[model samples]
Target: MALTNSKPKIAIVYASATGHTERLTEMIVDASVSQGLQPEIFPVKEFDLKELLRYDIVVVGTYTWMNGEIPRQLHSLFEAIEQQSGDLVTGVFGTGDRCFATYCGAVDLFRDMLHAKTQLAATLKVEQMPSAEDRLRCDAFMNSVWRKYSQHVENLVAAKP
Candidate 1:
């Protein structure tokens, strides 16, 4: 379990319709940069599912659709993730309106799947456009995910000869 001393690869994959999720992506990227970690951003449609395993960390930003259903665009990525061997550290976040019965159900759906498929670090959901309050939450999410990865690497090193 000894992770490489080099920096871990990080990818932020997301889907946005009304731009709320995209905004969240910006916040996450900013937070990661503030923490000195560079994360590559990918739109769900453009990201190659085949390239998923190349990253040590994956963060998904999604939008709910059709009453809590995960966006159709996300289905392939979801399945690909679930099929992985669970070494990836993942975080899930999304945006939705409160009027929906499921709120940000897309995030919840991704959360559950990632939890089972990878080392899940954090899950975040924001209403419509993000507010100032959500920025703090974004920082917390970045901290949590980084902390999870750091602790795991530390454990590996401690257990090393």
Candidate 2:
């Protein structure tokens, strides 16, 4: 859809317990800035679910815990997202120890749900904290999301009466 005159609002909503997800969020935010786009990052508890309507792009980050279960704190957001119409563009990413069978399984869970509920763009999985090498992957993820969003906006504009 054609965005308003104002720049698209992007949100990086995440839940990080041991700070790995938070660190990844920082990397995403930095990549966004480098692309000349400003994005706001919010902890899952702090983000008002209703505010989701205001964003054109939504990025979710989390850490996979025991048995690949979605963390308790993020469950609400997960449900809220699933209830949303499939219009918003979305990306999912997370951190998990590679030793686990379900490494970054939380990201997979979110990916499935978001694909059903929104326009899923990219999904990323990083083992533990992101290292310097992961920056390229992060950039590619952001770029893919932005490219899809831009295409959507262009399609909307072209369809104008």
Which candidate number would show the highest lDDT if scored against the true structure?
A: 1
Compose the digit string of candidate 2's lDDT tens values, residues 40-150. Answer: 889989999999888888899999989988888999889888888776889998999989888888999999999888889999998898998988888999988888788
Model 2 TM-score, 2 decimals: 0.93
Error of 1 at 97 (Å): 1.1
Predictions in order: lDDT = 0.89, 0.87
Candidate 1 regions with alpha-carbon error over 4 angstroms: 158-161
Which residue pairs in model 1 clash with each other?
none
Question: Candidate 2 at 141: error in angstroms?
Answer: 0.7
| Collision count of model 1 | 0
**TM-score for model 1?**
0.93
C-alpha lDDT of candidate 2 relative to the true structure: 0.87
Off-target runs (Cα >4 Å) in candidate 2 are: 1-6
For each candidate, give its TM-score against the true structure. 0.93, 0.93
